[model samples]
Target chain A: MTISVLVVDDSPIARKMIRKALPADWDISIQEAGDGDEALAIYRSGGIDVIFLDLTMPRMDGFTLLEKLQQDDLNCFVIVVSADVQPGARERAMKLGAIEFVPKPIDPQALREVLREYGVMV
Target chain B: MSELLLNDDQTAALQEIANIGMGQAGNSLARIWGEFVALSVPRIATVAAARLPELIQRCVGDGRVSAARLLFHGAMRGEALVVISAADRRTLGSLMGFPAPAGDGDPGAQLLHIAETLAGACLGGIARQFEATIGFGAPALIGEDLPARAVVRADTLGVDLALCLEVRFRVEARSLAAHLVMLMPRQEVQGLAVLLDRFLCTL
Candidate 1:
């Protein structure tokens, strides 16, 4: 079965970059969401195996979305994509149940490693 | 209080400096999008934070407005930038070769990404020129009905003054337009002026 993915961010460029960074061989169907509300809607519809979420956004942020998804006990891997690498943001995201925290100005190699760890690709 | 405003010479200097910084940002964006981007002549204006609503309405008018907001924090300065209009976002997206959404999705995300990239490039360029270690938080989408206090707190702390600089741009090939508004604390503004003066003297 092909893995399904959801790319959630408020930036079109970020989503595009993440889309490009994904391995080409993976049989994945990518979907997009702009904010927490939209992401939640997609999650409720099911079939997604992985989520790439942004931290800062309008209407609802990634943190809140993570919280909600965890609260609902939804079964999907969430990897946070953020530029806020101050001090504790990463720890906080991991503690909140995000599988990984990826910094902005994304490095393709890093994304490959994360995807491999999540078993989204070999 | 009137001294907070830029004088003719200072205005001209700022125009030049901002143009240079924005040009650098445009080049970085162009490389990422693979298209040519041009910024309009800078415009200077002074207003209290309370006027932001009217400012947004007037500047954006009826045109669809999409914004990318970046917040900067530091001991020497604090700033907030709002990049406005959807057309500009679409142009940047097209340049990046993002396929149109095949399903229901937030189109705003693409714009936010472009805005974040632009903010990083502009800030990097400005910091390179000033030799300052500026910190940028992240970029987010600004709501049309953004609270005035949110923007006020973004630029000022208690009694500190905020210097607001507005930069507009037009993408000629796409016929799209956008604006970049930077809000820096008063002391940073003064420091920036001094730095600009020094740079000008050398030039």
Candidate 2:
């Protein structure tokens, strides 16, 4: 079985980093979204099992995206990859139903652990 | 430094917020470059609106510098900037995988992209500390000679008191360094102080 992942961020560099950090051995199909609008479109189309989201994007931000996901009852696991790592960031993301909060520059080991814990690895 | 604009508690709270924000920014940049980057503990101050220009001058000195700035408004209005020595432009460009400009000309486009991304990330991180909603305009370039005035007048109208936070960045095993400066309006500072006090009460 293949796991579908959506990586969303405005910066090309950041999106690239997140993609690079994914576990090589996993049967994962990756898709990219430069902003929340695009991410939402793809997400609404279904088949996304996990989302790597960034908070401060151009059009739609990660916070709004999280809210939308919850409103529509999307059951995918979300891991927030953001530079806005303030005191309340983790709590806020958790409140929005994110399974993990990883501050950027993305750490591969951390990414791997989160994937494993979430059962994203086959 | 003169009269102590913020008391010890306020200053400490702001510094802690800055530290968290900068640490997140450093981690983001490190991920992009696939390397570790270190960030300094941010130095924060609340200064009278009148003293802003002089304070900026002292920080930059008489060096050839360039800045990328973003103006934000909402619960509080202010700007965030990343300033770097002009000579370091090439190094930054190289680090980000942008080829050097033809000859020794300006560092355009690519540098602006980096600046905007970092500014949004760092400032957004800081604003979240107070649970304030801040909106940022597009990033604009401000030459060394003009950064102080540009920062002070980021709003559409006249000047206002400001909170300044300066954090330095040093990339691992690289000769590049940059300063991230955030200027928050006085009203925002007061609101943040109230929020911090309330936060302490909860603690």
Per-model B-chain TM-score: 0.75, 0.81
Residue range B1-203, candidate 1, lDDT tens digits: 33455555566555544544565666666566554555444455655555554555565564556566777654225555655554455455556666667641455676667667666666565555556656788677665334333333423344334566665555567766556677665556666677666645643
Q: Which ten-residue region of model 1 chain A has the weakest summed lDDT? A: A83-92
Candidate 2 per-residue C-alpha lDDT over B7-85 given as tens digits, one digit per residue, 9 for 90 to 100: 7766766665565567677656765555455555567777666777566655655456677777877755677777776
Best by lDDT: 2
Worst 10-residue stretch by lDDT in candidate 2 chain B?
B145-154
What DockQ does every candidate get? 0.01, 0.06
What TM-score number comes out for model 2? 0.56
Error of 2 at B46 (Å): 2.2
Instruction: Please provide, for model 2 over A66-96, each residue's C-alpha lDDT reduced to its tens digit, 9 standing for 90 to 100.
Output: 9999999968999998765553556777899
Report model 2's chain A TM-score.
0.96
Q: List residue ranges in candidate 1 displaced over 4 A.
A: A1-122, B1-3, B74-76, B87-92, B104-106, B144-161, B200-203
| Model 2 pairs whose backbones collide | A104-B27, A104-B28, A105-B27, A105-B28, A105-B31
Estimate the TM-score of every prediction: 0.51, 0.56
Q: Is the docking of candidate 1 incorrect, acceptable, medium or high quality?
A: incorrect
Residue B171, candidate 1: C-alpha displacement in angstroms: 1.7
